[model samples]
Structures are given as C-alpha cells and as structure tokens.
Target: MALVAQFLVADRVAVAFAKREMASQIRSGALADLPCDTPPPTVSDVSIGGFPFLTQVLTGSFSDVGMTMTGLPTTGPRIERISAHVRGVHVPIFRLATGGDGTIRIDDMRAAVHMTYADLNAFLRTQPGRVHITPVDGGRRLEITATANLPLLGDQQVGGVTTFAVHDNKVTLVPSEISLSGLFNLTLPLGNLGSYVPQIPIPVGDLPFKLTVTNASTDATGLSLAATATNIEVSTADQKPCRPTGS
Candidate 1:
C-alpha cells in the first residue's frame, strides 16, 4: 500500500499549498488573476489527522512564488483616510475682491495635507516613495511635494506629485507624480492664509477701526470718507481730503 499512501499524501499536500498561495495573493491584492481552474493550493489539512509527509509536500510547493506570476488577480489600491497640517513661512501677499457697494471680501487661503497610517501603508505598497501636488491659483500656479516612510510594510520611503490651477473661488487639484512600485500615493494637501494677509488697525479720531489689507487688491487700498458738520459747509476744493487747511 506504499503507492496508495504516497498518492494520498501528495494530494493533501497539494491542497494545502494551494490554500496558502491563495491567502498570500488575496492579502497582496492579486488573487483574482490566479487561474480559475487551479484550485487554491493547501497544506496539511488540519481537518484531517496529522500527516507530516503531506505537510512537507504542501510547504515545498510554494517555495519559489513570485509577485508577477500569471493567473493571479490584482486589486486596486485603497485609501482609508487622510489628514493634513499647514505652517506658513514667508507667504506672499494676496488680494481680496470688492463689491459694488464698496465692501471688501477676503478669501485667499493655504494649508497642508497629511495621511492616516492605514492609508499611508496601502499607498506605499503600490506607489513610489515621493509625490508632488499642484494646487489651484486664479491665473497662478502652485505645487507641493510630499515624502515619508512607507507604513505597515517597511521603513522604506514613498511619495507623489500633483499640479493644479486656481480660479475665481475654486482650487483645482492635479496629480503629477505616480510611482509604479507602490499601490498608491498617501500624501494629503494642506494650506495657510494668514501668511498672505496683513492686519493693520486704523484709529479714526476716537473710533478704532481695523483694516485687513491684502496687497494688490483694489479694495484693500480703498477707503470711503463722509463728514457732517453743524452750520459749517464741508466741501473740499480738491477731491482729496484737505489736510485741515492751515488755520
């Protein structure tokens, strides 16, 4: 019965090998590509009595597996979550828009992005160790680069690149960098606005007024003046406010 025993052991080992290979493929996001006809390999069937020889056969079956093997399916990279923080330094001045009624409106902003540990790990598995991002700027261009250590996998670094443009009130995001090595890019976008706006408090007589002026904006530089005096006609010879005509 030696031949019978050998066949049974071989079959059990084959099944076990298939199972392990299937598990690995699934975890790596590449199980769908595996040949449909080929049953998942299995090792020592724990369901059955101990079979040391069968286990050895199953273990030996997958000793030379590679990532690109044919018939195994591949899964798309997933994004769990993203977070970001922005610290502005030497930010350039910006301009704000004004309404027909002479009211000024400011809306310029800047910030930075960050990724969660789970998302970051998934990204590094599919993409490279570096990334770049481009943000929207009304007729202006901006770009950012992100880099960090790959999470959940190893100490290796990964990143991406993006480019975008800005319009009246919307910022467009552009993806510029994509790595083939990792599964995805985990970089988040962040921004800061205070860096571009200057706060200046103007004291008007006894009333303290605060004026936030953004460089290059018409509204930021415009100020309306109105005066009322009892029994005193107030009219400036020149449109400009007359420096109290000396005495």
Candidate 2:
C-alpha cells in the first residue's frame, strides 16, 4: 500500500510540476492562443500508472499519466480529464528541476479526459435548478433533474432520463425521458411548452489534449466521460515564475 501510494504521489508530482510551470508561462502570455478563459487554470488531481516512478523517469518513458483541471473558462463546456498514455517522454531531471530549457516528445501518445455533471453546471452560464446529473438503472439510464416553470402550471418539477453522446470533439446531452412532476398532482395536456426549454448549444467543456471522446457513464456523483489522443508534444524548460502581465 505504501509503495502504491508513493507511485501515485510521484505521478501527482509530475503533473503538478508541469501545471505549475505552464501556469506561470500562460499568466505571462508566453504561450498564446491556448484554451482556457484565463491563464493558470487549477490542477485538481493527477495520477500516473505503471508505477515505480524513478524507473520510468530513468527509462526515458512513462507508461501513463492523467490529470484533472478546473476553471477552464472556455466559451463551450470544458472537460477536465487530462490523461495520457505517453511514450518517449524524455526529460533530463537535473535540468528540468532547475528550470532549464528542455523539450520532450511522445513517440506515441493517447491523452484522455472526462467530466461530471457538476462540471457541466460549472460551465453553464445559467443552469436551471442548479441541474444535477446522476446515473441510475444499472448505468443503463441517466437522470437529469432541474427546475422548470410552465404557464398556468405554476412551478413544475423537472426530471429526466437523458443519455449523452460524444462526437466531433463534443458531448451532447440528449433527453430520453424528461419527466415533469410536482404539479400538485395536476395533469394538463401541455403541448410545445416542454419543447420551449431554455436549452442552449453550449459546448459545456473544453479539453487541452487532441483526444476523441470514447465512453461516458453516470455514477453517484454525476455524468462521467473519457477521451484519448496520440503523439502529443510538450516542453518542460519553458517554466518560469508566474507573474501577471504588467504586474
């Protein structure tokens, strides 16, 4: 268990170092045209697989690495599952630690990402009922609950079983069964009102890696998703002290 924890910690450290380094550059505008509303997004979690960190570092290749970032600030929805199956990751330790200029390339890379319904709400400018997403029915169905109001219906409760698909570098939340309840046990033949939902075509989440969404599911927390990519390029030596422009 201790060994496992250390491996996990090592992976976390690698990502944290990278995030910390790039955050400084982004805030300083060294790397432009990058995603994220503002520079220096938050690195929430990181994990590296195929442990025994020192061996991988010395071997000049890492088997896998993943990270979660928050505060993307993208116009569309932003997914934060920033993970990768990295190969040929060569970094000179002593120089990298000293903030020396170094470059690394992946012979083959498959990066990935996933997001939760809570992450969905965070990206949405105005979410109805502070929308919550959960998985039900043995992961065969998804439940989306929100608040809605109908004319002459007073305040109606809204819940739905929705399924989402990931294509074209985007995730689409499709409603399978939008259940309307909490109307004082009143049933009315409401037509076209439900269709007038304030649904917007927001991307919801954006990711940094060039990955394609592969799978999605719901759990106790919210909707989950995954994506993967290959041969990603990165630089380590560009890291510097994070100082806001004109500060």
Candidate 3:
C-alpha cells in the first residue's frame, strides 16, 4: 500500500512537470510566425488528456492536449480567446520532464478564435460612423447602429441587420437592411445604400500554430473562427535544461 501511494504521488508530479514543459513549448513556438511587436497572447488552462499518464510517458505519445490562449492580436480586430486542441503529440518523456532537448511532433491541431462584441466595438470606433454591433437571433444576426452624416439629413442614427460570413481569411459583415431613425423612419435596401454603409472586415490570417481559417460562427458570447492544421513540429532543442526539483 505504501509503494502504491508513492507511485501515485510520483505520477502526479510527473504529469505536472510534463504540463509545465508543454506550456513553455507552446508559448515559445505557437506564435513564432507573428511579428515581433505583437503582444504575446496569454497561454493558460493547459491540460493533458488521458488516464494513467505514466503509460503515455512510457509510450512517448500524448493522445490529446488542450489549451486556451487569450488576447491574440490580429491585423484587424483582436482575438478575445483561442481554444486549441492538439492530438497525437509525440515527445521524449525524459526531455519533457527535465526540459531537455527533444523534438515535438503534433499529428493535428484544431483551434477556435473568438472575438467579443466589445473588441468589435473597439474596431468599429475607428471606422467612418463609429458603428456598434449587437448580436440578435442568439448572435446569428447582427444589429449595427451608427451615426451617419448625410447630404440633406446631416447626422442621423442609422441601423442595419447584418450576417457575418468568412471570406479570404476575414470575417465580412454582410448587411441585409438599413434603416434611418428620424422624425419619419426610412428603410433602405442594400443596393440603394451601396457604400453608404461600410462592410466591416476583420482579418484573421495571423492565427498562431500555422492554423488556417476554415469556417466561422457566432453565439451569445461572440464570433468564433475555426481553424485546423496537421503534421506540425516544434523543437525544444533551444530550450535551456531545467533542473529537477529536489525532494
């Protein structure tokens, strides 16, 4: 019984060490492609999935690993959150535990980038009319309000309904209807509005981990960009070796 307890404690310690090493690796290599000036995203909530982690260590293969990174900067709107799932990760257990040299191979990874309405508002504030976005239909549709200057009407509060779509690594706001709020309310068709209302595009091509945007959706929280990639490799060769905590 004492031996079993010792083994359990050792297992827990090993898992914690492995998790820390993995998090460091992710922080170093995840956004390597981004610009140096870009603020580093906060990496947290790292978990290694699977039971009896020692078995995985023996095999040097992790079945599933998940992590969350927040405040990812893009060329346009900032990404509020990024949920990443990695599968089939291979690494040397000794190197990972001791923070030594090794190569990490990931069979595949899927990431979801989330943008909150607050961040959307930040981007809109820089645009022509200082537009604001409100999600309707549980975020499936967007209600955008802006103060527009017109030829005869001067500055008036104009609003429209738009649905978001992904095109060319960007989230494009597609407005279907526009209405002017005044003494007499007037609704205009999209064709008539033309460029009167701007189509907002949030570029998302700079997501980390070499993941490419594939699809996008929205919910009550905000917009989410789904991305996926395969056969990614990262090296821990440059990492300074870590000393094991003495018991």
Candidate 4:
C-alpha cells in the first residue's frame, strides 16, 4: 500500500510540473505575440483536463486544456476576462519532461471575452464625442446616448435603443429607435440623425491564440465576444507565433 501511495504522489507531481511547463510556454510565446501596442495579458488557472495525465503524456495527446486570462488590452475597450479551451493538444511527453523544442498542435479551440459596462462607458467617454450605455429590458437591449457637437448647436444629446450585431470582426451597435431629449422628448427618423449620433463599433479581432470572432452578445455585466479557431500549430519557443496548421 505504501508503494502504491508513493506512485500516486509522484504521478500528481508530474502532472503539476507538466501543466506549469505548458503554461510557461504559453506565457512566453502566445502572450508575447500579442500586438506590441498593448501590454501582454496575464494568464491564470491553467489546467490539463482528463484523468491519468500520465497516459496522456505517453500518447502525446491531451484531451483538453483550458486557461483564463485577464486585462487583455485592445484597440478599443479593454477585455476584462478571456477564457479559452483547447481540444486535441499534441505535444510530446519527453519534450515536456526535458523542456526541449518541438511544435505543439491543437485541433481546435474556443474562447470567450468579456467587458464590463463601466469599462465600455469609460472607453466611450475617451472618444471624440460623448456617449454612454444603459441596459434595458434586463440587458437584452441597450440604451445608447451620444452628445454630438454640431457646428452651431453646441452640444446635442440624442439617445436610442440598440441591439448587438457582429460584423467584420466588430460588435456593432445597431440602434432601432432614435429620440431627441429635452424638457419634452421627441422621436426622430433614424436617417435624419446621421452624423448627429455616433455609431459605435467595439473591435474584437486580433486577440491572442489565433482565434477569430464568431459572435457577440450583451448581458447585465457587459459585452461578450465568442471566438473560435481550428488547426493551430505553434512552436515550443516562447516568443514564436501560432499559425494555422500549414502556415
């Protein structure tokens, strides 16, 4: 029984070491490969899923791997959280054990990013115009208000209700109804507003892990971006870029 216990303890130690090594590699490579303009994101909660990790080591194929990253800076709003999962990760056991150079292949991966309403509001306030977002109908729709500085009107605040739409790797604010606010609110034609209102597009592309934006939605907290990628191959080198299977 004592000998069996020793073996089990050693197995757990090996698993921990392997998971740490994988995470280190990711920190050095994928995180560094992020856009130079933004600070590198911090990674956490890295886990290698499936039991008997040793068996996976022997086969050089992991069933599942997941991690969470935070404070991912983007061109527009900062991403508060990003959780990613990879399936069919292939890396040699010996390579992990010896810290040798080799290529890591991932069959597919999915990732989700989140941004808070407060953060979105902060981002909007920094733009050329003034805009704020409020959730309506339990966050199913958004009430967006923008203050435009017209040539002679000084500043005019207009508001509208909009839903999220994913287009060209951006989350577009598609306003359904527009209204002008004063002592008495007046509903206006959407086309007439034109440049008087701002069309906000939250960019979600160019994130790490080579993932592409698939969809976007909003909730009580903030906006969520769903992304996916397939056939990823990255080198063991910490600073190398992950590429598609062939490229």
lDDT of each: 0.27, 0.53, 0.78, 0.75
Error of 3 at 48 (Å): 1.3
56-158 per-residue lDDT for model 3 (tens digits): 8677888999999886667778778889999998877676667467777889999988888888888878877778889888897789898766657777788
Shift in Å, residue 161, candidate 3: 0.4
- Against the true structure, candidate 1 reaches a TM-score of 0.15
lDDT of 2 by residue, 1-247 (tens): 9988988888767655654543333232212235322455565444545655556655545566444555554565565444444444454544554656565554554544445556676664365444555667655666666655666765567677666766676676655555676645443333465463334343633454344566666665555556565665555434344466667
Scored by TM-score, the top model is: 4
Model 4 score (lDDT): 0.75
lDDT of 1: 0.27
In model 3, what lDDT does residue 212 have? 81
Residue 187's lDDT within candidate 4 is 82
Off by over 4 Å in 4: 1-6, 35-39, 93-99, 148-155, 192-196, 238-247
Residue lDDT tens for model 1, 134-193? 333431333333343323544333333433223332223333432323455444332232
Judged by lDDT, which candidate is best? 3
Clashes of each: 63, 13, 0, 2
Off by over 4 Å in 1: 1-145, 148-151, 154-156, 165-168, 180-247
